[model samples]
Target: MLYSDIADVFDRLEGTSSRLEMTSIFSDFFKGLDPGSLRKIVYLSQGRLHPDFYNAELGMADKLVLRAISFTAGVSESKMDELWKKEGDPGKIAETLMKNRKQASLFSEPLTLEKVLKNLTMIESAEGRDSQDKKMKLLSNLLMDSNPVEARYLCRIVTGRMRIGAGSMTILDALAEAFGTKEDRPDIERGFNITCDLGFVAETLAIGGVEAVKKMKVTVGNPIKVMLAERLPSISLIMDRMGGRCAMEFKYDGIRVQAHIDRDSVKLYSRRLEDMTSNFPDIAAELRKQCRAERAIIEGECVAIDKDGNMLPFQNVTHRRKKHGMDQAVEDYPVKIFMFDILSVDDEDMTLRPLGERRSKLNETFGLSDMIQLTTMEVVNSPEEGEDFFNRALGKKCEGIMAKSLSQESVYRAGSRGFLWIKYKKDYEEALTDSFDLVVVGAFHGRGKRAGKYGALLMAAFDDESGKYCTVCKLGTGFDDAFLAGMPDMLDEYLSETHPSTVDAEMIPDVWFLPTVILEVVAAEISLSPIHTAAKSIMKDNAGLGLRFPRFTGRVREDKGPEECTTVNEIISMFEMQAQNKA
Candidate 1:
C-alpha cells in the first residue's frame, strides 16, 4: 500500500468523533492487508518502530534530527532551534517551511508502506556507537526532496513522535471495531495478555480472524508486554468491601520495578517493561549475589531512602534513574528492593499458581536476607488490625497499605490493577483528596519561571461504562520548578488535539492527549460541579463529580494507563462509603 493511501485513511480516522466511525476507517483498510503486514501497520501508526519492551530505538537524537531538518528545509541550526522551542517538534517546523518551498512537490516521492516498514527495521537495527549521523542521513535521503506533508510524517517516523494521536489503545479500539467484536474484547485482550504485543494481536486478527486469537495460550519467560496504568489515591476500602479480615503491607513510596532473573544474570525492568538494568545496578548486583533460585521473576518497589530503614520519597528514588553518573547515583541514592511477589522461579512460571503457594515459594527462594527483604505483609482476621497497620504506615511517612487477598485462587495477574490487590492510603476517604490518577489532556505554555516548559495540566477521569474520559480536575501544584520545567518535554509523546477513548469531556483542552501516560494526582476534595464533564448527571441534578484542588503528586505512576484512572463508579462507591461512615 502507498503512504498516501494509508495517510488518507489515517486522516479520516483522526477526523471522526464516533468510535463506530473510527472502527469502520480501520476495518476497511486492514481487511485488504496481509495479517502480518496489518500488524506492522498498527505499530507504525503509533510512530513506534517496535513495541517498547523490545528496546527498539531509532537511535537518532535532536542534534542529528536538526541536521536533517536543516538540510531538508534549507534552514540554519539557530532558526531550527527557535522553531523547535516554540513548536516542540522539528518535523512540524520542517513541514511549515517545506510547504513554502517553490519546488516542494518536485521533491515528493511516491513511496510504498513496505519501504516504510523496511526503513523502520533498518532504523531499529542501527544502534549504539555513532549511528545517529547515519540514521539522520537515511531519513534525510528518504525525504530530501519530498513535499511538506510527506516531510512532516517522515520526520515524525524518524523522531518516534507521530503526533497523529494514533496510540496503542486507539489501535486496539480500531481493531475491535473493524473485526466487529467489542464482545470479543476480552478474547482480543486474552490474545494481548498472552502475546503482549498489539502488532501480534492485529496480525492474529488478520490471519486467523477472531478464532485465531481465541486459542492463544500464556507462555513463561516469553516476556509478554504489559499495558501501563494510571495511578489512584487508593483508600482502605477493602475493609468495607470484604467485611472480613485482610492482609496489609506498607505501600512503599518508590518506583515499581519488575525483576527478571535467570541463572546467568538478573535484569530489572520498570513497570512499563523498559530495560532498567543500569538504573539500579546495586539491586542487580545484590539480586545476583543473594537470590537463591537460579531463575526468578519477582516484582518489587525500590526506594532511595536508607539501607537501614528510612524510606525516601518517590522523587528521591527517581534521582537514581538519571542516565549519567551511574556510580554516584547509586551511592547518593541507595535503594532498597522490597520484593512483594514472585511471578516465576527456576524455569517454572508461577504467576498462575495460588498466592499462598507463590508466597511460600518466594519465601523459600529468597529468604529474609541482605539483598532481598520481604515486603511487610501480614494476614489479619479483622479490619481493625489492617486499619492499625495503615496508621503505622502513615506514621512512618509511608504512602499507605496494600490489602492483598490470600486465597489460593488469588494469582498474580499482570497488567491488571484489580481488587485482588487494593491499596489503602490516608487521603482516599477525604472529600477533597490530593492524589489520584488522571489522563493529561492539555498543557499551558510556561511563563516566568516556567517560561520554557509546561505550567499546568488538564486532567480527567475514566467512565468505563461510557468508554469516555470525563474532565474531573486541573492540576497545578505539588511539583517543583525542575519538575515543571520537565513536564512539557516528558509529555510531548502524549500531546494530541483530542483525548483518548478513555477520556470523555465536552470541554476540550488546548491540546488533546494519548491515553498512554498515567499520573498520580493530589487534589483537595471531591465536589459537585456542572462545569466538569466527569459523571455528569450521575450525581444530584446535573452537578457531576469534580476535584476541588487538584495537584500533581510527586508520584509518576509509570505503571498505569488512563483506563485505570479513578473510575466514575469507583468515585461514586467511595462517596457512598464516606457517607455511610459519617452517618
Candidate 2:
C-alpha cells in the first residue's frame, strides 16, 4: 500500500472532529489492507511505528526535523523556522515548503507503507556519533518521495505529534467494524487489554479471526493494561455502590506499577505502560527474590520512603523517574512496593477471577517483607467501618482508602474504569472531598496583574455516554505567576480557532482549545447551575451541575487522557450527595 493512501485518510480524519466519522474512515481503509500491512497501518494511523509500551521513540527533535524539512524542500533552516513560528505547526510548514520546493529532484520513488515503517524503525534505532544527522537523512529520504499532503503527516509522525484526535478506543471501534461484528468487539478489546498492543491485536484478527483473538491470554512478560478505579465523595456512597461488604485497601500516594515476573526475569511498568524496570531495580530484585510463583503479573504502588522508613509524598518519588543518577537517586529516595492485586499466576489468568480470589492468591504467593508487602486492607460491611479504615489510612500518611467490591463478578476489567473499585480520598471528608481532573476546553485573557497571560481556564468533565466534554467550571485560582506566564506556550499545540466537537460549553472564552490538557481541580461543592452543560437537565430542567469556587491543585495529570478525566456522572453524584446531607 502507498503512504499517500494513508495520508489521504489522515487528511480526512484531521478535517473532522467526530470520532465516529474517523472510525468509519479507518474501517474503510483497513478493509483494503493486506494482513502483513495491517499492523503497520494500525500503528501509522496513530503516528507511531510500534505500540506505546515498546517506547522506541523516533527521537527526532524539532531542530532535526527542521533540518530534514529544509534538506527536502531545498530551503534554509532560518526560512523553515520562520514559517514554523507563523504556522505554529511543523507539519504544515513541511507541507507548504514541499509544495513549493525550489529544486526538482531527478529521482522519484513512490513511498510504500513497508518502506515508511522500516525507515521510521531505522530512525528510532539510530544512535552514537552523528545520530542526529543520520536521523535527519532518513527522514529527509522519506520526505523526498512523499507528496505535499503525505509530507505533512510524515513530518508529524517523525516529530511524535499526530494531532489527529483519534484515540485507541476509536481505533478499536474501527477495527471491530472492519474485521468483525459488534458482538466480537469484546473479544478484540479483551485481546488488546491483555496484551496492551493494538498492532498485535489487529494483526492477529486479520490472520486468525475473532476466535484466535478471543483465545488471547495473559503472558508472563507481557504487561496487561491495569484496571482503574472511579471516585465518590463519601464512604457511605462507595459502600452502598459496592453492596455493603467490600475490601477497603489503603490508597497509597505514589506511583502505580505493574510487575511482570517470569522466573529469573522481572519487569516493571508504570500505569501508562511505560517500561520502568531500570528505574526500579531494587523493587525488581525484591520481586524476584520474594515472589514464589514461577510466572506472575502483579499490580501495586511504589511509595518513596524516608531514612526512618516513613512514607514520603508523591513529589519525592518523581526523582526516581530520571534516567540519570539512578543508583544515587534510589539510595536517596528508596521506595517500597505495596502489592494490592495479582492479574496472573503461572498459566492461570487471574484477571477473570474475582477480586477476593485474586487478593487471596496475591497474599498467598508473595511473602511479606520490608521492601515488598501487601497493602493494608480490611473487609468492612458498613459505611462506618469503611470510614474508620479511611481515617486510619489518612493517619498513616496515605492518600485514602480504596473501597473495592468483593462480589463474584468483580473481576479485573483491564483498561477500564467503573464502580468495581472506588477511591475515597482525604479531601472527600472536607467540604470538597475530592479533587476533579478536568480537561481544559477554553481560556480567558488575563487582566491587570495577570496581563499577558491567561486569566482563567474554562474546564469541563467528560460525558462518556455522549463522548463529549461538558462545561463544569472555570478555573482561575491555584496558579502561580510562573504557571500563568507559561500558559500560552503550554497550550499552544492544543489551541484551536473553533470549539472542538467533543467539547460542549455554553459559556464562551477568549480562546478555545482542543480538550487535550488535563488539570486537577478542587471545589467547595457541586451545585446545579443554569449555564453549565455537565449533567444538563438530569437533576433539574435546563440545569447542570457546576463546581463552586473551583481552584487548581497544581497537578497537571499528564498521565491521564481526556476520556479518563472526571466524568459528568461523578459530578451529579456529588451534587445529589450534598443535597442528601442537607436534607
Candidate 3:
C-alpha cells in the first residue's frame, strides 16, 4: 500500500462526520492491504511506528521537526518560530511556510501512494539515536523529494502528532466494515484480548478476511486488562431490580489488588494491569510466606492506616506507590491486605467458577495471616439487611458494602461489570460537592479584566476504550482571584493547537492542550447532557454525561497524568448506582 493512499484515506476520514461514509471509505481502503502490511498500515495510520505500551517511543519532539520543516521550506528558524507561536501547531506552521514559498506553484508535484508507503517503512527502521545532523539530513533529503503538503503530514507523523484522528475505535470499526459483519466483532475483540496486539488483529483481518477474525478463541491466563467498576451508593438499588434475594459483602476503602502467584513468586496487578510487584514488595513477600498453594490468582484491597487504626485517605497511600523507595514508602505508610475473591488456584484458571465456590476455595487455601486478612462480610438476604451493614461499615470508617450474587453459578467476568458484584456506598449516594480529577484539554482566551490569560478551561474524562480524552465539563471556578490571575503562566507550557492521541472534541477552544494537567473538581451532582462529549450517548440516546454545578476543587492533582484522571466508565457506574437507589 502506498503512504499517499493511506494519507488520503486519513484526510477523508477526518473530514467526514457520518459513520457510514467513514466505514465505506475504509472498506475500500482495506481491500488493497495484505495481512502483514495491513497490520503495519494500521500502526502507520495512527502515526505510530509500533504499538505504544510495550515499545519505547521514537521520541521526536516538535522543535526538531520545525527545524526540518524550515530546512525544507527555505525559511529562517526565527521566521518559523514566529509562525509556530502564532499557529500553535507545527503542521499549521509548516502549511503557512509552504504557502509562502516563491516556487510553491499550483502545479507542484503530487505525492504518490507508493512513495508514501516506502518512506513510512523507512522511518520505522530509522533509529532515534542517529545524530541530529544525520537525522536532519535524512529529513531534508526526504523533503527535497516530496511536495509541501506531503511534507506537512510527514513531519507530523514523525513527531507523533499525525492530526489524522485515526484512533483505536476507528480501526475497530474499520475491521468490522471490511469483514462485513458485526457478529464477528466479538471474535475479533477476543483476538485482541488474547494477543493484546491490534497490529496482529489487523494482519489477520487482511489475510483471512473476516474468516481470520472468526478463528479467534478464548485463551486463559493471557493477562488481559481487567475491567473494574465503582461501588454504587446503595444496595437497595442493586436488589430492587433483581428477581430474587442477593448476597452482600463489605466495600473497603483501599487500593484494589489482583494477585497472581506462581511457584516461586507472587505478582500484583493494578486495575490498569500495570505490574506493581516493585511498588508492593511487602505484599509479595507476605504472599509467598503465607500461601500454601503454588499457583493462584486472587483479588483484594490494600488499606493503609496508623497504629491507632485510623483509616488513611487514598492520596496518602498513592504517595507511597513509587516504584523505587519501596522500603522507605512501606515504612511511611504500611498497609494491611484484605483478600476478598480468588480467580485461580493450583494451575486451574477459576475465573469462570461461581463466587460461592471461589470463596470457599479461597477460604480453604489462604486464611488470615499477618498483613493478610479476609474481608468482613455477612450473608444478608434483603436490601434492608444490606443497608444496615452498609451503615455499620460507614460507622466503622469503611467505604460501604459490596453486594454480590452468591449463587454457585456466579462467575467472575474478567473486564466486565454485570449484576454479579455491586457496591453500595453513602458517599456516592449523598450528592457531595463530589471531587473529580479531570484533564485540561482546551482553554478559552481571557477577555476584559482577564485579558492576556485564560478564563474558563475545558475539562475531560478518560476514555479507556480509545485511550483519549473526551470533554466532560468546563471549569472556571474554585480559583481565588490570585490563582486566576496567575493561571496563564502556569498553563502556558502545556498549550497546544492540537489534541493528543487520547483527546477528541467537536468544539475547539482558542488553544488546544496536551492532556497533561489533572485538576480536582467538585460538583453538586452528575447529570446527563447532550453537549458534553465525555461518555456521549453512553447512558441513553442523545444523552451524554457531565457533572452539574461543577466547581474547581482547589487541588491540581499534579502527580497524575490525564490518562490517570477519572474515566467515563467510572462516571457511568456512579450514575447507575444512583438510579438503583431511587428505584
Candidate 4:
C-alpha cells in the first residue's frame, strides 16, 4: 500500500475533534489494509516508530525539518522560515511549499510505505560525526519523492510532533471497531497492557485475529505496565473494604522501579517503562548479584540513604537521573532497593497468584543483601493495628502505608487501578491525604516579570474510563524564576498546536499541550466548579470537581507517566474525604 493512504487518514483525523469520527475514519481504512502492513501504519498513527519503552529517535529537530522541506521543495531556507513564522505547523508549511515545487512530479518515484519505514529506520540508526547531515539528507530524499500530503506526514513523523489528535486509546477503539467484537476489547487490552506494545498487538489481531492476541504472555525483557493502587479516606474504610485482614507495607518515598533479572543480565524500568538501568547502575548490579532465581521480575522502590543508612528525601535520588557525573552521584546518593512484589519467577507467571503467595515467592527468589531487601510488611486484622503501622512508616521518614487485599482473588491486574490495593498517607484531615500528580494540559501566557513565558498552567487528572484528561486546576504558584524560565525547555515534547482530543477542559488557554509531563501538585481543598471537567456530573449535575488554591510541590515526578498521574476517581475520593472530615 502507498504511504499516502496513511497520510490521507491522518489529514482527515486532524480535521476533526470528535473521537468517534476519528475512530470511524481509521476503522474504515484499516478494514482494507493488508495485515502485514498493519504494524507500521499503527505506529505511524501514534506518531511513533516504536512503543513508549523503546528509544529510537529520528534526530530531526524543527529547524532541520524546515531545511529538508526547503531542499526538496525548491523553496529557499529563509523563505520557509518566513512561512513557518506565519504558519506554526511545519507539516502545513511542507504541504504548501511541496505543492508549488519548482521541480516536476514526473521525475519522482512513487512513495511506498515500505520505503518510508526503511528510510526512517536508517535515519534512527544514523549516528557519529555526520549524523545530522545524514538525518537531513534522508528526510529530504523522502520529500523528493513524496506528494504534498505525504510530505506533510514525513516532516511531522521525523520531528516527533504529529498533530493528528489521536492517542493510543483512540487507536485501540478503532482497532476493536475494525476487526473484533466489543467483547474482545478487554482481552485485546490485556495483551497490550502486559506486553506494552501496541504495534505488535495490532499486527497479531490483524493477522491471526483476536485469538492470537489472547495467547500473548509475559515476556522477560519487555517491561510490564506496573499495576497501580487506589486511594481511600481512612484506615477504617480500608479494613472494611478488605474484610478486616490485610497486608500493610511501608510506602517508601522513593522511585518505583521494576527489575527484570535473568542469568547474567538485569534491566530496570520506571513506572513509564523508561530504561533506567543507566540511571541506577548500582541498583542493577545489586539486583543481579542478589538474585537466586535463573529469571525473575521483581518490583521495588529505589530509596536514597545517608551516612547512617537512614532514608533521605525523594529529591536526593533525583540527582541520579543526570547523565554526567554519575560516578560522583552514586557516591553521594547511596541507594537500596526495597523489593515489594514478584510478577514472574523462572518463566512462570506469578501475577495470577494471590498477593500472599507472590510475596512468598519474592522472598524465596532473592537472598537479602545490604542494597537489596524486601519491604517491611505486617498482617493486620483491625483498624487500630493498621493505624499503628501507618504511624511507624511515617516515623521512618516514609510516605505512609499500602494495604493490600489478602483474598485468593487478589491477582495483579497490570495497568489497572482498583481496591485490591489501597494507599493511605499522612494528613488525612487536611483536605487531600497526599499530593496529587497532575499533567500539564494547557497554559496561559505570562505577564509582567513572567512575560514571554507561561503565567499559569492548566493541570488535569486522568479519567481512565474515558481515557481523557479532565482539567482540575491552574498551577501558577510555587514556581521560582528559574523554573519559570526553564518551563518551555522542560515541556518541549508535549507542546501542541491545538487542544488535544483526549483532553476535556472547559477553559481555553493561550497554549495547549499533549498530556505528557507529570507534576506533583497540592491544594487547600477540593471544591465543586462549573468550568472544570474532572469528575463532571459524578457528584452533582453540571458541576465538576476542582482544586482550590492549587500550588506546585516543587517536585517534578519524572518517574511517572501521564496515565500514572492522579486519576479522577482519586480526586473524587479526596473530595469525599474532606467532606467526611468536616462532618
TM-score winner: 4
- Candidate 3, residue 220: the lDDT equals 25
Q: Give lDDT tens digits, candidate 2, residues 1-583.
A: 7888889988898888788898899899888888778898788877788887886788687778888888888887778778877776678888888888765477978898888988899999998998988999999999998889999999888877676767778888888999999999888998998998899999999888898898899987677877878777678888888888999999998989999998889999987677889889999999989999998999999999998889999888878888898999988899999999999998799999999899999988998789998999899999889878987998999988888888999999997888998887766555555779999999999899987789999999988766778999989999998899889878866776566666789999998888878999988888889989999999889999899999998887765667778888877766765666555
Model 1 over residues 4-75: C-alpha lDDT tens digits?
676667557656656556666777787788776787778777676566566667656656777887886678
lDDT leader: 4
- Model 1: ten consecutive residues of lowest lDDT: 227-236
Which tens-of-lDDT digit does each residue in 51-125 have in candidate 3? 543333444567877777888788888888788878766766766676676775454355555555565556545
Measured with C-alpha atoms, the lDDT of residue 21 in candidate 2 is: 93
List candidate 2 stretches off by more than 4 Å. Answer: 102-104, 429-431, 441-445, 466-468, 485-516, 528-533, 536-545
Collision count of model 3: 8
C-alpha lDDT of all candidate models, in order:
0.70, 0.86, 0.69, 0.88
* Clash totals in order: 26, 2, 8, 0
lDDT (Cα, 0-100) at 161 in candidate 2: 69
Write model 4 residue lDDT over 1-583, tens digit each, in one string. 7888889889999888788898889889888988778887888886778887886677588887887888777777778879977776778888898888767567678889989999999989998999888888998888889889998889888877777877777788888999897888888888888889888888889998999988888878878988888877789999999999999999998899999898999999998888988889999998888888889899999999999989999898888889799999999899999999999988998888999999999888899888898999999999999989998999999988999999999999998888999988878746566789999999999999888999999999998778789999989999998899889998755677777878899999898898888899988899999999999999999999999999998999888888889999988878888898777
